[model samples]
Target: MVNILEFIIRSKALYTTWIYYKPNRLLFDVGEGISAALGNKIYSIEKLFITHSHVDHIAGLWGFINTRNNAMGSREKDLEIYYPKGSKNIEDYLNFIKKMNKYLRFKLYIKEVEHGDIIPLKNNRCLKIFKTRHTPGEKSIGFQIIEKRKRLKPEYRNFSGKEIKEIILENGKDEVLEEYEKKIITISGDSLPISPDIIEDSDTLVHECTFIKESDRKLRNHTSLDEIKKLLTYISPKRVILYHISSRYNRLINKAEKELTESFKNIEFHIVHPEEISII
Candidate 1:
């Protein structure tokens, strides 16, 4: 069976964060310490998507670019980075990185994307961006991987398997199904509880659960475990991988994970501990 998601992720609130999605060679948020963790695998990444310019979310860019250019690996593989369109901080930081690496050996491309924008990928998949509420005056976004497919239309759902096969054999499959898009994965990059519609029916959701305890949150920016639970009441995802958790919740993490698993029996739950890398 094909793996739904193959990723190495590390996240700690206010510290550093990054996700290396192996299937498509996509890296999300090049936070500090990522280079030391990913090492040679950095050369395999084709694109890096930044949700925002917060230091914790982007501090690794400098090291990543420098390492890929100088480290013992192929230097000809091109690297493309996509960030929110209105993020001036990321634009400036990318400029600084380019300036510092004047003798770079590879092609470094940077593009600014916004909500409702689509970035095409290989294997009939694409990435879509949606606006998110992170910090006041800071423009943040979330990403989802959508796949184009054809599925049986609602009007054809009641047909028996044999009858459906006969219909398809006679009329062709296109006559029984309609073209649609399926959201296979989503990343909630350091934002408030993502809207339910944005994540509904996803195969996997990599959401930021920064505050395990609701009372610990002072601002409306970061998400809490309670919010995630509430969000689940509206939509169902096959897997919910929680990350970017605060270090102070080390003791509370186990208990929270147990409860989450118990309550959402159908959804697999994963917690990315602060001090270690989670391979999934």
Candidate 2:
């Protein structure tokens, strides 16, 4: 059985948005209040994957960088950050951060990433990036965690235990087993409903639900609960976490969650209330 992921997430449209994936010490989008939310744990983050340069999504990055440099924690650890390639806004902001902290204590590494870039991680896992649609003129992307797995080949699956043992002993285990990729998680950084084709085989999906009511959204850049419902019909994941929500529907979250649970019986639903931090 797959283990449930542990995460700390907060998203309030045009205010702040961030997610801390505990298992990998990975922080996605360094929005405002991140330093306060994570406290000293901010030093534990080894890498950061940014989706875009929106102020609400990356406002606290300077605080984050400064805190780690002076905070009372592990100070020598190097920090690596990856942002969407060709994001001139992000580049300019990063340059400002460097100038502000001229006497930094630790090393800071930054990279510009584009679609199809694969960042290898420990435990046979990798982080893959893909493009996402957001505000016009703003470059954005999404992330997926994929794992390498081995399973019995199709031709050997129906064999009896004894037969399989004999075949393995004769031909070696590698001959009967095949390698495959399993998408562990998918995070849709602030965007309209992401494509179902990308999240089809993923176990967990962390998507933005900016407008609970489709009628409330005037711009086509964000997604709504109704659109998410339609998207879920195309791909079924074990869990769906809705974040980057607008504060207007704070009182209606429970009702929406209840409805989705009834509709997607086999999938777990988690909504990150915009007013508070959500730990799951």
Best candidate, TM-score:
2
Clashing pairs in 2: none
Which parts of model 2 are misplaced by more than 4 Å?
Answer: 1-5
| lDDT for each residue of candidate 1 in 1-280, tens digit (9 for 90 to 100) | 9767599998998999999999899999999999999999999999999999999999999999999999999888999999999899998998898999999899988999999999999989999999999999998999999999988889989989998999999999898999899999999999999999889889999999999989998988999999999999999999999999999998888899899999999999999998889999
Q: What's the lDDT for residue 69 in model 2? A: 85
Listing every candidate in turn, what is its Cα RMSD in Å to the true structure after a full C-alpha superposition?
1.9, 1.7
lDDT of 1 at 233: 91
lDDT values of the candidates? 0.93, 0.94
- Per-residue CA lDDT of model 2 for 138-230, tens digit only, reads 999999999999999999888999998998899999988999999999999988888999999999999999999989999899999999999
Per-model TM values vs. the true structure? 0.94, 0.96
Query: Worst lDDT window (10 residues) for model 1?
Result: 1-10
lDDT score of residue 96 within candidate 1: 92
Error of 1 at 104 (Å): 2.1
